[model samples]
Target: MNSKYQDFVPLKAIPFVEFLINEHNFTLKIVHQRETKHGDFRSLPNGKFQITVNNNLNKHQFLLTLIHEIAHHVTHQKFGKAKPHGKEWKTVFQHLMLPFLNPEMYPMEILPYLANYLKNPKASTDSDVKLSLALKGNIAAAGKNFIFAIPQGSLFIFKDIIYQRGAKRRTRYECLNLANKKAYLFHQNVEVASYQREYS
Candidate 1:
């Protein structure tokens, strides 16, 4: 992992990069963008890939985009870009998302979303979880509001939620409010101050 990623996602970036190098034999390149974009592609294999991560995004978002793009790279290496989020891409997503689902290894910055998704990805989806949790007062705070119970990892969401998901869970969650809106969680907790507070 480079210093840039270290400055952003100090913990997961290295492990994620190692996963790419060892498991996929790929290198990571970070690029800052003018627009609020959280990682995109440039080239691949013979060409260099530019992960245009959203500088505005928090450490958790940055890490997620980085991992997501890396997963894309692996998918591209294994199967050239054909269909968006194709079978191979989905498979890679599954693999990457699986570990985060594990209790011992999950990062705190990504827990609420992961927990909701893992518990009932279809029912308790990220958005749904954020909504439910936010409604319950588990809101995300700026700066170091995130904390990892695991001393080594650098994220807050990993500590709070269990990663194990049960069968007969929803594969997707529906959030009417989330749709047609621009909202994202801060440290797995919803940012509600700016938006209307859904006081229960």
Candidate 2:
């Protein structure tokens, strides 16, 4: 286990990290929080492979994202230029995630959801609402309110932008950005600080 990533990944997850580094010769990097993606894998021209995971992720999410990126690395090695989340990657991801499905590795509350998710994993954990919500439930709630908790037509601040919640569209909410009045879809569970409207 590398001393540098001690603070990034939980102690229990160190063995899996070591396995990836030793078996695949992968270089691990903990990057700043990225709003769009959780992790990424890149195979350099010099035959060096690198995996980067978001620093903001909790223990479970961090480990999951690490394995997800490693699956990509392994898939790329086995079949170059293959579909990103094709059958090969799913097989690798499931195999790698099998050992961590127990209560010892994950909280009992989230273990069941995670186990079911592994049966047919999606491109991103966020795509699985149940699993994603379970994972988020383990983490401490932020000071900001959750988007789904707010009323429709409520105004809120998200990523420094103001938006008014419109209508529910399946798993996401339609929000109109106040700055440019452009509509965008946001996950129903996204956290945002509510902006109190002033009465004239």
Candidate 3:
């Protein structure tokens, strides 16, 4: 463990590294050096990665940076390469980010900025609140009386919903994929769908 990150719980650190090694096949390296004018995590060509948490960084920021670097490692393994803050990196970064984030790490004051940069940080598995069809068309939904004027080929992000087993009166949602001109329907009060190529 780096002296700079002595406060981080070992249980949190070890499992995350193991997750990278086991799932993403990455080798983590901790190095000592003068602070560069750049980021704390870097990946080498040989699937080796370096994570540097400066002595001055606070606990939350350090953890965030560590996860961010790990995300880079995951992106490299998944896509062979990543564009700076592109879709692949953002997806992985957010995946790693949520596990450790708290009110301090993600305050309401910073939400708008983070949300814009994250570009849909709350994946389908993360939230129960789903945006409505009319909202995408610059209209709004009112108490189950929402209107839809969306055309075909529309893209949507369904939020995570909780469904009780054997419940007959299930929550249902239907919309169109404007881009593909296909109809999409989901039951909120049902088992979460398995990972299908459709979402990707």
Candidate 4:
């Protein structure tokens, strides 16, 4: 295990994470938070793959995002240019996540939801409302709010932008951007602040 990343993931996940980093020979970057994404993987112009995970995530979310990005790498290696969140990537993500899904890596409160989510993982963990909220519990901050937790017609702030939460559209919540009046669909688990506060 690399001591350098000890603070970023559960102790039990360190060695496996390190092994993936070493074996894949790709760059893993812990970057500042990006409101639109938790992590991403891309092949660089220099002919190397780089995976970046948001620095703000708690250990559990961080590990999940890391493995999620790694699954992309593995999927690409196996089936070049496969659909981003297609069956190939799903299988790879599930297999990679299995070793880290134990209680040692995640709290008991999140296990059931996490297991349920892995049964058919989505492109973003946020797509799994229960699992996303369960993981957010590990964050140090208190009184965290989510889009789905707020009442419809309520004003909330997300990514420093104000929006009025609207009706549910299938899985995501429809929201009207206060500034542009443009409608956008937000994942149910997207963390948001009350109209008066700034969360991100």
Among all candidates shown, the one with the greatest lDDT: 4
Query: Tens-digit lDDT track for model 2 on 1-200?
Result: 45665676667667867777789988988889998899999988998999999989888889899999999999998899889999999999999988787776798889999999999889999878778889888332565776888899989888889999999998899999999999999886677877884211
Which pairs of residues clash in candidate 3, taking residues 3 or more apart in a chain or in different chains? Answer: 152-178, 153-177, 153-178, 153-179, 154-177, 154-178, 154-179
Model 4 bad stretches (over 4 Å)? 138-144, 167-174, 180-184, 197-200
lDDT of 3 by residue, 85-144 (tens): 578978888777665444444544443444453455432211222321211222232212
Q: Give every collision pair in model 4.
A: none
Query: Candidate 1 has what TM-score?
Result: 0.49
Worst 10 residues of 4 by lDDT: 138-147
Off by over 4 Å in 2: 1-6, 138-141, 197-200
Tell me the alpha-carbon RMSD of every candidate: 11.9, 2.8, 16.1, 3.0
Poorest 10 consecutive residues of model 3 by lDDT? 126-135
TM-score per candidate, in order?
Answer: 0.49, 0.88, 0.41, 0.86
Query: Sorted on TM-score, highest at the top, how do the candidates line up?
Result: 2, 4, 1, 3
- For all candidates in order, the CA lDDT equals 0.46, 0.85, 0.45, 0.88
Worst 10 residues of 2 by lDDT: 138-147
lDDT of 1 by residue, 4-102 (tens): 456666454457545654675545555554432446655756665545565655555555566667667777777886454566766676677665444
Which stretches of candidate 1 lie above 4 Å from their native place? 1-4, 10-13, 21-27, 33-36, 44-46, 102-109, 115-200
Arranged by lDDT, best first: 4, 2, 1, 3
**How far out, in Å, is residue 34 in model 2?**
1.6
